[model samples]
Target: MPSYPGGETEKAAYDLATKGEKLVMDYLNISIFDVQEMPIDLYLFFMREAYIHGNMRTKEGREYLENCRRMEQTKPDRKKIRKKIQEQKREG
Candidate 1:
């Protein structure tokens, strides 16, 4: 699961995910379940496309984008984490 930044809660994540899912479904004429089955990269592409072309200048859109940015910032750097783990193992 993706992590949320400071001041972001699970509720906020839920709201964003549901709203984004709805937007994708309406834009693509697909169902929520269909979206659930989409690859993460494809789903993100559609989400970004929707944000760019779907008139996201409104207050809600701005908030959604802000939340998206926060969520993105919280994604762990796997390479850095792995390097740390390896260094620890070598030292021990």
Candidate 2:
């Protein structure tokens, strides 16, 4: 099978760029505002690459991929998963 670029490259690049910025911020005390746009443009490049050669395993797979794409586009923040504890309180 042809090795296709994974469809999550934009998210991956975002993650990488964030890490890079974080490193610079932590170590060099540089501001993200100083070099902000290159990563964003690189993100678009990643998207285009994925669009051209994303792996579509099945129709359902394609749908799932698109859903993830939308999610990344929106940067959908997820609520923390907290476990609910059962309380045994008896009222007299």
Candidate 3:
């Protein structure tokens, strides 16, 4: 149900979502169905704690952090997308 502007912006959004989903699933050893059916409030809270605060303490968390770094290194377009988001925040 989520919609995004077309082209690179949309692609970037999907790419980011895929990465996040993978991180959550891998960390929890949960299926995609679990993530899909999770309540929004719980999902947000879990992700915030597991993905951010969990960093370097657990194996899964450390792997996720390393994967994130690798993603940023390989995907140069993410930098542009980030800048655009920052500009939008400033304008809003």
Candidate 4:
């Protein structure tokens, strides 16, 4: 089976400049005036942080899904376990 590397790239997309700007703006949760008031360095710092957090979230999501897939492929045959479902765990 061919394996595909998952998750999106964090590289800035010049073609989506407007959308990127909007993302940064929304990430900061501040008004346009506040954004303009920030220094270039500060703005860049926040934008970098936004992308970092977005990438981390995507990475975690992918890992969770991959784990789920692996578990599905390897689960024990339920019928082989004689224990009643209600007696299986500590909920009692």
Candidate 5:
């Protein structure tokens, strides 16, 4: 994951994606935890809809953008950490 270098526009995109995910989950009667295991195709479809149709200037949208930023920053780190753990286990 990397920072939203595009500033407000990138933030808006991330916010839209978050809102889209939530809406999809709620519509499907799924919990937040279940989202992690959601099918990528469905996720992408929902996110695309969100970006294309969602209003990114709303208050909730802005608030959730922070989460988007945090997730972006940590995504790559999680993979790297997992790889490191696997390497350590192999060595040990």
Candidate 6:
């Protein structure tokens, strides 16, 4: 995550994740995973926040942000997960 010089980084990370979850839910047309599922979102979000912070700031921040941007640009493969959910429903 983008560690700010002060303690602001934590809050920035949290906000990034929260926004990411919302985007995921909307774009994927699925329910948010439980607490356990949120970790993925949190991880990706931290990277994204770090990247944004890095872009206009220090060199370290920029490097971290670039890495995060690369990660955030990736889309999750939902086909398998959706298929699995469908199968469970069929069996149940």
Q: Can you give the lDDT of residue 71 in candidate 1?
A: 70
CA RMSD (A), model 3 = 13.6
Local lDDT at 11 for model 5: 30
The stretch of ten residues in a row with the least summed lDDT in candidate 5 is 1-10
lDDT of 4 by residue, 1-92 (tens): 11124433356645664554565688988876787788888887887666555645786655645554555565675764646664676467
For model 2, residues 1-92, the per-residue Cα lDDT tens digits are 11234533344333453644454444434466743544767544544444424447467557656666665554433432122222222321
Model 6 root mean square deviation, Cα atoms: 18.8
lDDT agreement with native, every candidate: 0.72, 0.46, 0.64, 0.62, 0.60, 0.56
TM-score of 5: 0.30
User: Candidate 3 lDDT, tens digit per residue, 1-92?
Assistant: 11122312223333464665666677788997898788888777666655565566887656666666655565467888999999999999
Please provide TM-scores, in order, for all candidate models, with all chains considered together.
0.43, 0.22, 0.40, 0.43, 0.30, 0.24
Residue 38 lDDT in candidate 5: 79
Question: Across residues 1-92, which tens digit of lDDT does each residue of candidate 6 receive?
Answer: 43423423444433454655555555445565742365676647654554464355777666655555555656765897799999999999
The sequence of per-residue lDDT tens digits that candidate 1 reaches over residues 10-62 is 35333453877877888899999999999989998887677555646677556
TM-score of 1: 0.43
C-alpha positional error of residue 57 in candidate 2 after TM-score superposition, expressed in Å:
2.8
Query: Worst 10-residue stretch by lDDT in candidate 3?
Result: 1-10
Q: Which stretches of candidate 1 lie over 4 Å from their true place?
A: 1-17, 56-92
Off by over 4 Å in 3: 1-14, 57-92
* Candidate 6 minimal-lDDT segment of 10 residues: 4-13
- Quantify how close model 2 is to the true structure by its C-alpha RMSD in Å: 15.8
**Candidate 4 backbone overlaps, count:** 0
The 10-residue segment of model 2 with minimum total lDDT is 80-89
Clashes of each: 0, 0, 0, 0, 1, 2
